[model samples]
Target: MVLIDRIRYLLEKLLEVFTIFLLLALTSIVLAAVAFRTFGSSIAWYDEVASIGLAWLTFYGANLAALKRAHMGFPGIVSSAPPALRMALFVLSEAIVIGFFAVIAYYGYHVFEILAWDRLVSLPSISLTVTQSAIPISAALFIVCECLTLPEAWKKMRAGVDSEHEAIEEAIRLAEEDLKENRS
Candidate 1:
């Protein structure tokens, strides 16, 4: 359990860092495109490259969000539920999400297989598989992260670690702040 938690924390941090760079790269591409367009010599591949970067950023970001359990949900209703039911609902919700992403991860690998031989016309440096594969990769990582946190959750049920959701929410909040600062 300790080992899994450590690994999950490490992976979550690593992915968070990578996602930051991908976002910055996307921003740089967009800025360059805008600047070049103003001078009437827009790079032909800037848009395409930026689009691919954006896709990677979006999916990877989603995965990171999932790991943190930070994706948006109807918190109002959850908050209104009875205490016992609320906890049950939370577990059920996480389980359902895990199931959904597990399926996504499975099919995502197939998609990667189908697109394995293909390359992007504008960005040949990045294969189609690399882009499509993020889905499954993220799904798999999310599952691992959730699973790692589950034991701790059970341990804290009496005293309530709330660690899984709380930690994710905190991480997401920090990431959002970092993003805003970077944009500024």
Candidate 2:
């Protein structure tokens, strides 16, 4: 693949690894927090740490979802539309989603800056800045992934299918058409 493709691949891989690590970390933290609370011992920072990890995990997972087209939507609407209208709607929806996420990424950057300067009172253990950094980082990554996915979606919308999804869709379409023709 080309440089940009390679970069995207690497980012995706890194995000995948980060998501798994964060999930495991969050799970462990939750279990430990439960144990501590049960024993009448409190770890003041556990909640904050878990929240931060969960936020990061969620953002990365959202990006992964977008990349895989795993984000939930009402498929029946799109599937029922005529092809041209469906394509237009698909492109429009993707554009709207990208624009919304772009705004989010912008605000996330501002939040990160503010966090960097401000300290959390309860957990002076880690700077609020560090915790806030994950927002912008994940938002930026999400934006990148959405942008990368748009063209592929558009291509699929227009061309019916491309190298990526063509084989499977084509196979299914052929089978369905054959069944219909045979029935007729």
Candidate 2 lDDT over residue span 105-172, tens digit each: 78987876656767766677668878777766766777788777666566666655433344568789
**Candidate 2 has which clashing residue pairs, if any?**
115-129
* Cα RMSD of predicted structure 2: 6.7
Candidate 2 local distance difference test against the native: 0.76
Per-residue lDDT of 82 in model 1: 69
Number of backbone-clashing residue pairs for each candidate, in the order shown: 0, 1
Tell me the tens digit of each residue's lDDT in model 1 across 11-90.
78988999999989999889989999999897878877787788888878876776665667754556556678767877
Q: C-alpha displacement of 44 in model 2, angstroms?
A: 1.7
lDDT of each: 0.77, 0.76
| Candidate with maximal TM-score | 2
Quote each prediction's TM-score. Answer: 0.73, 0.75
